[model samples]
Target: MIIGTVDCFPTKSTLSKLSINNSQNATGHWNSKIQFGHRTVNKQGSPLDFKLEQAIVSGERDDFVLITANFTVPPRSTLPVDYELIPGVGYYKLHKEPQDWHTARVICNKEGAHLAIINSHFELSVIKMLYNRDPKLHDFSYVGISDLQKHKTFVTIFDEPLNATGYTNWAPDQPNYDGNCVVVKRDGQLFDTQCNGRFPFFCEQTLGK
Candidate 1:
């Protein structure tokens, strides 16, 4: 039911019953000067006739309805993202395309303040949903954090320490000796990979204002 435009006109009997004569205004707009039935009946018996004391053409009526309907839609309070959020860790999404770790980081950075950070098993569960359609389920996705510094053991998008003691859920052999960047795999597991290796990445951000 995709109705584009509809012109609602009063039935001939309705117009005759209303006894509207010379009801057309100078602007060629219909006017409901004549009253009949329980309500005023103009050439066009639009709801606006009751509101505006006028008879409008079909197009004007449609525009009025559209504007009214738009005003009725509840304002969206939250930001736009296609995934649910974990209470603390961050929002989780499955990687879809091949992207280098750096590019992935940028994508997440654009998403919000916190950037993409995965730390708990529950967060991983949400990431796994992205890989359900793919047969070759990978281990983790590329998060915003990386350990590019020679002295740093771990790095976060915020340039903070990985803080291995808290909110860290690295998989076995993760942050491998040669691997300098972190990415979350489709399986919700964190793994270290060459920073240049392209893979899908997820973005993270804080919820609400």
Candidate 2:
């Protein structure tokens, strides 16, 4: 069943859901929050011919409609463009353009992602591999972890303790830097650095849970 505010669909038939096996020309907006193949009091999924019968209301752009259907979604279609899948990790995009920590965070958020957080050694290794491939990238790239709330007490951008992330591979004498933000060196080691220092960064997006 399609749910959410009526602003996005002026009439009951303004939006419809479709599910056809191997069907062509079936396109719709994708959101990670929607779960497919589920039957609940508030949510359900099935098939119907999708159509737009009326224009959306102005100044009602804040709301949205979620339509779930049982259809095989193409693997490549689930990811945003320019993102490279890192196997077990997630889809990531390396932003070569320099930006400070706050700006980097905002940009990634606007892109429907967050600064890449190294959750495991395997993920760090993959990041290092990507880093080594491009020699032009800055030596230090901004990551999602920082000690912004409490000096020397590191945490992920989500405010989770860094130690809880399963990986804390820091360089020798690291956390020694006076800065409050974190960065990942090309060698795959974490370091604390100035939040205002501009540098390249990685953004990650996990989709279709």
Candidate 3:
């Protein structure tokens, strides 16, 4: 039987007991702490979903024993469009309409996702390949990661460093001095642009069900 459930929410956190043992180490116990740096508990599988999972507790204690987790869900934006899986990371998709960076982010948030945060060359290449290339539309797409507040240091909506996953796909010595937001051209190259510049965009469902 299911001892606990995280339930449905934009973000979910759960605390569960998996075989508590109060007497396992009563005599030899010593206080300790564990730091798992950046960990993921349940990712719908999209690195772009970049919702960080944190463990509030993972060790045994005489008072109680449980596993605690946290999920940060974005607010409802729109019905989520279908997504293509990027393997163990998460899911990704591109929209048909062009919108400014801020607007595109809002759309993705409404749809239960966020503007795509490219985590690897493979995933970034996949997005470039799969994005629609209708001749009648613009040639750029908005991406989620940005250095809007401070140049040279980019971040996602959740405020995590852009390279938190140890991958970056900036195009050449791009992100010119004046721009803040990022846009991806058809050649899989990224360039920083004004937040109000209109463009189609990539979105990610992140890791989770």
Using TM-score as the measure, name the better of candidate 1 and candidate 2.
Answer: 2
Q: Rank the candidates by TM-score, best first.
A: 2, 3, 1
lDDT of 3 by residue, 46-158 (tens): 23223344345545653444555443333222334366666455667778788888999988888777888777777767776676546555778888877877777878777
lDDT of 2: 0.72
Query: Candidate 3, which ten residues in sequence have the lowest lDDT sum?
Result: 15-24
lDDT of each: 0.54, 0.72, 0.65
Stretches of model 1 off by over 4 angstroms after superposition: 1-91, 113-115, 133-139
In model 1, the Cα lDDT at residue 195 comes to 87
Give candidate 1's whole-model lDDT. Answer: 0.54
Q: Give RMSD (Å) of candidate 3 vs. truth.
A: 11.7
For TM-score, the strongest prediction is: 2
Q: TM per model? A: 0.50, 0.61, 0.56
* TM-score computed on alpha carbons, candidate 3: 0.56
Write the residue-wise lDDT of candidate 1 on 1-209 in tens digits: 22133334557553222333335556677543333332322232212212223333467346332211111111122334564445434445555677888777666555543346655556556556556767675444577677787633777766777774245766786656578888765545566778898776666554433
Predicted candidate 2 versus true structure: per-residue lDDT over 90-181, tens digit per residue: 67788899999999999988877899888888887777877888997789999999998988899999999999998898999998959999
